[model samples]
Target chain A: MDAIRIDNLTKYYGTARKGIRGIEQVSLTVAQGEFCGFIGPNGAGKSTTIRTLLGLIRPTEGSAQVLGLDIGKDREEILARTGYLPSEAMFYPGMRVRDVLKLSADLRKKDCRREAATLCERLQLDVSRKVEELSFGNRKKAAIICALQHEPELLILDEPTSGLDPLMQRAFFEILRERNKAGVTIFLSSHVLSEVQRNCTRAAVIREGRIVACDSVEALSRTSAKRVVIHGRVDLGLLSGVRDLEETQESCSFLYSGGMKELLAVLAEGEVHDLSVSEPDLEEIFLHFYSRKQ
Target chain B: MTLIKHELRQGRISLVVWTGAIAVLLVICLLVFPEMKGEMKAISHLFGAMGSFAAAFGMDRLNFGTLTGFYAIECGNVIGLGGAFFASLIGISALAKEERDGTAEFLLTHPVSRAHVVTEKLAAVMLQVIVMNLIVLVVSLLSICAIGETVPWKELLLMHSACFLLQIELAAVCFGMSAFLRRGGFGIALGLTTVLYFLNLIANMSEKVKFFKYITPFGYCEGVDVIMNGGLDIRSIATGMLFAVLGIVAAYKMYCGKDIR
Candidate 1:
């Protein structure tokens, strides 16, 4: 069974007739144990979609199921089996880090003390400090511990590494990779395109509240335009089917979607010292998608 | 249960401050009652002649010469107003604070359902109200004893029971109001509490608006009514209770369907 199945899900901020659209006709499914990345810019409906699936906000139309349980009706059951890490980490004031972790575990009705201790140690979190006393990164570590300690079947993380330093982010992803290896299905919504590109097997790009593209990482890279850079005097103006062309004295680069043979035929006519053609990174690809939509 | 405990812990410091402040004020009033006992009759007549001012506070009906009478008017308003504010503040902040502090997303995504969250939070508010009243009751009893005055057990107990009920009614109403508020309800709670209080005073002063007594919790639990009648106004108490039940039911209805943004 698919771990998450969202069909024609739409959410509006007000009444459906007179409300701002949050997400429109969003339908996607993630196979069990697949690591799917949800990439979108700010206010692009990434958080809205995640919040709707988690039952924080009701959808204006359509339906969804998590772990085969209805998002609207079986919310408690779905939440029990899923762990969500929200973008912002806010805890009750005057509570110690360990207390917040304990409260989360208790709500789940599980004995997660051992797992919590291990996660805290691995993340280098100090459980003795009060929540209000901790820095932003430390609070995020506490939030990560809370989300991971239950050993859930599915993990949905929204911008999971915003405030963490690079080292801690590495540790956080290491933990996630281990969990994914242990048969956990992960849905990660992130702004850090490279992290998603490096970690996720499949990716879904959202633009203006719609899923503009969804495919395997390799397939997406293969299907989209490739970045071409030449290090010699070349007439980029002669290149057809190319956009975003940048020219310097020694180098010229542009994204090319034309056939490789035609590009080579054109390159042989120029005085070229070096030439490189590469699959564009996710960021560039996403920019392509955004610009194309606009 | 976990939610209730966490909520209680969050409100603990404010609870202590409110309860301690009211208890200290009550103790000070009760301590001076002994020295003022000799001049009570003259003072009672003096207040009786203040026309609407005396009647507004029910000072004209209850004799100020006796300990029960003195305690009723002096300490009654202190605890009445203070307790109402405390209850209103607690109830108003119960649900809204989670959203205001940006904790609702973290909370609602957990295994517990929204209905469960509302129930536990309402339970926490009720529990805090009861605890605060109990502490102040104990302090009042000990202070009366230390002053070597007769406890006037019947009137004192009835008056306190009425005030407790009054606090609960106000709490339920404010709790219902909290579901609709997003942030900074301090002014709203204070305004609601103050309006109801003045409405009771207006009802007491004017024969034309005497029916307004039925609308405010302060009217049914008036100190003079409890002291002179030796019991609560059953009809008015029933009205207040109906309001409380309506408030609680409305709270559950509105909160269960609310989008916790």
Candidate 2:
């Protein structure tokens, strides 16, 4: 069963100069235990979509369902079972980290302080200091703890890894993967590609309030042909025989639309001592999705 | 901590400052004003001066010079008007500051419901207003006792308690307005409080506009009626209670659907 199902969700934000339209006709479904990333640029409706799913803002049109509960009608029940890590957000400057966690625990009707402590230790977050005393990175970690401590069935995180150092970012994704192994579903939103590529099994790309593409990372890359790089003092134009040729002065690479047979003829004649042919990673596919050709 | 405690803590330093000022001012009014009394004509002339201000603050509900009259004017005029302003401003800020500071995102992502967040914050404002009123009452009574003057206990308690309710009822209105206006909570709270103050003015100015008595909690908790003549008007008390209930209901309903941003 799909853990979340969003159907034609649209949100319109009124403003003086061209209002922001978020997630127009955006629809997708994530199966239970799958880790999915919703990747987009800033103001591309990532946060708005997530907020709508959480029932923070009503959709201008359509609906979403989380764990079989309607997004609009069953918000409290849905929220009760879900963990969320909002992007950079505010905490009472006066609230101690422990107190913030305790307050959340009280509201959720659960005591995950021990688990929160464990997560903090694992994330290298200090639970002793007040929220105000923490740096941005530490604050995000604190928010992460509050979201994950509840043992929720689903985790909805908006730019969850933002403000974290590289080490913390990796640790966060590792934690997310481990949680997914425990049968938790994750819907993560981010603009950064590396984090999503490293953690997500699949992702959907949203552009200008509409989903432009959705697929497994591997399939999305495979759909573009293999890219071969001959990084050297080599003339990039020489590799033009290969399909989807793209070059920058000294080096050249191309998306090999055909099989390896086509690459051998082109490469055999060149001083390609160093050559590499690999399936395009998510980053390249994401570029292709957002590239001008689209 | 709930938003209430968080807010109360934020306002504590200001709370102390404001409350202390109120206490000192009331004590001074009690201590110095009595000795400065002159002839009956002079007293009546003085009452006339106080009455204009009283009428502005809706304190002419009784004769201005008697003990009950004095309590209504001093406590009701100063404490009542001032407390309503404090409570409404504090209440509105408490409700909307989370969003303004970008903290609502932080707080709302937790498993907590919005209802808990709002209710807890409002509870804190209630406690603050109570504390402020208590300071005035404590200072007023101590000053009266130290001066060896008698106070009508029943009327005094009724009037002060009514003052407390007036401030709280305004807080409820501010709290409700916060949910709908979000960023505009402060403006709405201030504007409504001002409008209600005038509505009470209009309600008192004539019998024709007395229908406005239903609109202003200040009118319902008329300081003069409670202070001078006797007990509170039950019908007016019911009206204040009704507005309070309505305010809470509106806050909860509007907030449940409000965007946390």
Candidate 3:
């Protein structure tokens, strides 16, 4: 069974005449036990898609299902099995971290104290501190514990690592990997391309409210253009499939996705000193996707 | 149950402060009633001479010389206005604060349904109202006894019951308003409470706008009206409760459909 299935889901912010499109004709599915990364720049509908699936906002068009339950009809049922970590970590100001965790467990009607304690210990979160008193990163840790404690079948996280330190981010992803290995399906939404590229097996790239590409991480990287740098000044604009060209007095660099002979011919026209070609990072690929009309 | 517990815990401080402040003020007034008893008749005439001011607060209808009259006019306003403020504060903040604090994103994503959230929060607000009224009632009863005054059981209970109903009406209305508010509704709630109060006063002061009595809960719970008529106003009570019901129904409908951004 699929953990999430969205079908042409759309959301608009206001009335028809003066509405802002949140997401349009977005369709995707994540099979159970798969770790899927949803990559998008800010306001590219990454959070919108996640929030819609969680039934926090009504879709303007189409429908979705989580764990085979209809998003509108079985929201509470879906929520029972799905854990969501919102981009922002906020709780009742006076509540202790432990209290927040306990409340989440209590709402789910599950005994999560053992898992909660374990997660807190692993995250090095001080549960005794008031939510208001905790540092931003510590607050994120508390949110992480709350999301994971119930052993949910599906975990949906949006920008979950924004406030975490490098060490905690590693620990958090390690915990997620363990969860995925234990048969939990995870959907992580983030703009941090390197993080997604490292941890996710498959990724979907969203730009301007639509999924532009969905493929295995390696396949996505392979489809991206190669970065070529020439030591001598060169005008590479005439070369097909060259994008994001930057020229300095000493050298010029551009993303190349053309015949190697064509790139070599263009480089030969200039008085060459040195040249190097390397694989483009996911950041460049995403930038390429965003710059396109589709 | 979990949500209810959370709501009550969050509101406990406000509950204590409001209940404590109103109850202390009532106790202090009741304690002074005995010392002022000898001068009551003279003061009553002085208040009667104040014309419209006396009528606005129902001092025109009850003899201040009597303990029931004194308690009705003095302690009644204390509970009426103070309880209204307390209830309105809770009701206004009950749902809106979740969004204001940016916790709605954290909360609404859980297994609990919106209906569960609304009902549980309403239950918490109702519990606070009942608890505050009960505490003040106990204190008022004890003070009356300590003063060696006749308890005026029927009058006391009627006034207290009326005040409780008034609070419920205010709470329900403000709770409905809370559904639409994302941030602070303090000014609105404050203005609403004060406006309703002055409406009652206006209704009392003028025969021309007597219909204002139907629009405000204070109209139904007037201490002098209870003292003189020996019962709560049935028409006013019906009207007040209808508003309460409308407010509660509106709250549920709006909140369930609202987008939690």
Task: For all candidates, state DockQ relative to the true structure.
Answer: 0.81, 0.45, 0.88
Candidate number of the best lDDT: 3
lDDT of each candidate versus the true structure? 0.90, 0.77, 0.92
In terms of DockQ, which candidate is stronger, 1 or 3?
3
Candidate 3 CA-lDDT value: 0.92
Residue-level error in angstroms, candidate 1, position B240? 1.6
Candidate RMSDs in order: 1.9, 4.4, 1.5
Tell me how far the alpha carbon of residue B251 in candidate 2 is from the true structure, in angstroms, after superposition. Answer: 1.7
* Model 2 agreement with the true structure over A121-158: per-residue lDDT tens digits: 89997778988889999999988888899889999999
What lDDT tens digits, residue by residue, belong to model 1 across residues A93-194? 989999999999999999999999999999999999999999999999999998999999999999999999999999999999999999999999998999
Candidate 1 TM-score to native? 0.96
Residue B130 lDDT (model 1): 94
Interface RMSD, Å, model 1: 0.9
Off by over 4 Å in 1: A232-241, A258-275
Interface Cα root-mean-square deviation for all models: 0.9, 2.3, 0.6
lDDT of 3 by residue, B64-134 (tens): 98999999999999999999999998999999999999999889989999988999999999999999999
* Cα deviation of B213, candidate 1, in Å: 1.3
- Determine the backbone clash count of candidate 1: 0
**CAPRI-style docking class of model 2 based on DockQ:** acceptable
Q: Would you list the rank order by TM-score, best first?
A: 3, 1, 2
